[model samples]
Target: MAENLEPTPVDETSNRINTPFNRRNFLKYTGLTMAATAIVLTGCDDDDDDTTPMAEGSVNLGTGDVGILNYAYALEQLEAAFYTQVVANAAFSTAFPSALERSILTDIRNHEVAHREFFKAAIPAASRIPDLTPDFSAVNFSSRASVLATAKTFEDLGVAAYNGAGKLFTDTGNGLTYLTLAGKIVSVEARHAAEIRDLISNGDFAKGDSGIIAGRQIVDTNGLDVALMPLEVLQRAQPFIKQTIVATGLPTQ
Candidate 1:
């Protein structure tokens, strides 16, 4: 039996459920959480030349902390777009007939949207990357298997992406603020990944036999989640993205 995973509002202090988790609350929470580290840092000197030649249609994700933020922004854009379509598809009802499943997907959709918007607002306009166009042409949203598989791919990829980029953040002042932010988001992403995995198979949530960890060796023998380089992550993500992403400006160390 699927769990009743409806989104419910909660008192932050008392932990009592109230109303549904809406966009306003989402933004308010994220805003308050990020207030201290919200200062937008300037691009690094190495990435000063934004005009550095690239593939005809490629967009460079500027260097330093800004570059890393753009990389995360790009992925969030992809995820938000994907979930939006999943819920809006004509066959969404049939694809996920169970009310519990529908609620889960809907909650995930709302979370992804909030994440996308948060990045957009967090990054300064001058440094933020353009809204990306996702290529979900191959996703058959009408089929539960197809949609779940795709969702699994995305969630797993998101978790690894954050894990990979966490160490790349150079702005660690104020109690490792950037890493703290990344940790917060990545924890949510990991939960989504686990939920989607369980949805696919009854008890496959934390198994290391599949997804990016198994395929890319991102998980270590000691049961630690390892990081992937920005370039590697972008390469795996390119097929789903319409715009060419240039990550050369991002930190390789």
Candidate 2:
């Protein structure tokens, strides 16, 4: 999630969770909504320029093993937040039409929360990223299309993220351990991706170009799945994060 508050809250500001999300705002606001009316007073600025300035606060994900752990942690936070919203919404039952469908999503939600918590416990307090704010303003929790589509994006991104991180943990002694855990978690993400894709369209699960979609594509032609550098993953995931996710120090691919 983006970390800065616009000079003033406007019509479309995004937000994160409520357990004092301050690395930015602690409790001044809730959810991913802009107190648009608050900014209305500033509307009368006479300046001819109309371009919006980029947000200011930035969150560094750190470097080395810690950075990669934080990276995975950040993503789990996003997925957990998104799925939590889905299951809590009154429209949840309507969105999934079948008990099996609902249960699957429920299971996925639990899995995400577990993953999020795992990272929180695995990483040291000083190293872990703050609980992120999610900006799913464009998502319609009640709509089946919207929910499944968004789920697809998150699961697929999670898989690719872990895939790319594998090579970074090459500290042979501990590398195997990290890769093992990541492998186990990503396999779950892959399953979730396929499930969501099939829900979206039975045959659409692996239909996209190479690694972009949930298929067997690899870091290369061996068909292992796409591997995104930390920065690349951050760019794609940024829109959903209300907090700014800085990936500058992570190892480059």
Candidate 3:
């Protein structure tokens, strides 16, 4: 039944913009492939889940690894919604839309959708975060700077959250599989972060001047990066969620 939540249909032609594409450009921006067989299929029914609905109210994610995973899932839901809206309602210039810009947006949209779906599939029962209606009314879709800046914020925040939560994952209990998946997803998220950064300011690949200058360091190994724990990220997302989330699932603490 989880598959019932299919992504809203997209209007390709209307949203299309002519942008250039090159390996260097492609390397600069990396995101998940949007085209997938997102079909409704018979899966485990979560009808019996007792947790409150994500949109109606908040449910403490409980304490422990499960809680951390749930927290990450909630954030993913937020990012996905933002990108979905961006693709559905894109901005363009009077000149032929740049091929690079159009391709990047499309890829970003797809990546967000894939990440959202992955979380849903991983924890269908309790991972549905309330959908936040994006407040892009203030953003000029026609402006590349505005759009890419927003993208940078989301991507950077995502990487930080995952890094902070990685240590909390219980490798002993959940099996290494869970940790492996997290690493894979986080790597992809880091790629997104770097790409967004490049768009905002060329030659400004990594703000964090980590020793690993061989490549960009989107997320530095810091205790609490500003982008990592942004309360605004939560505030902008609160409109979609009605209740405060609590951490749950540890041995009665």
Sorting all predicted structures by TM-score, with the top scorer first, yields: 1, 2, 3
> Candidate 3: lDDT over CA atoms?
0.51
TM-score of each: 0.82, 0.74, 0.63
Give one digit per residue, the lDDT tens place, for model 3 in 1-253: 0121224543344321111123233323333221111211122124424335444445555444545555666777667666655655635432216667566766766556666655554555543333323344455555667777667767776776666566655545333344555676778777777777777667675676431222435544663333333233344445544356544442221
Candidate 2 per-residue C-alpha lDDT over 1-253 given as tens digits, one digit per residue, 9 for 90 to 100? 2223222221223444421113223123221113321222122122321111124555677666667777898898899778767776788887777877887787677667666655665665645667677889889988998998789888888988998898886444422356666776888888888888888878766656434544545344565667787877888899998667777678997
lDDT for 67 (candidate 1):
82
Winner on lDDT between 2 and 3 is 2
Pick the TM-score winner: 1
Candidate 1: stretches off by over 4 Å: 1-23, 28-37, 40-56, 213-220
Q: What is the C-alpha RMSD of each candidate to the true structure, in Å?
A: 8.0, 13.3, 9.4
Q: lDDT (CA) for every model shown?
A: 0.72, 0.66, 0.51
Look at candidate 1 and give me any clashing residue pairs. Answer: 9-19
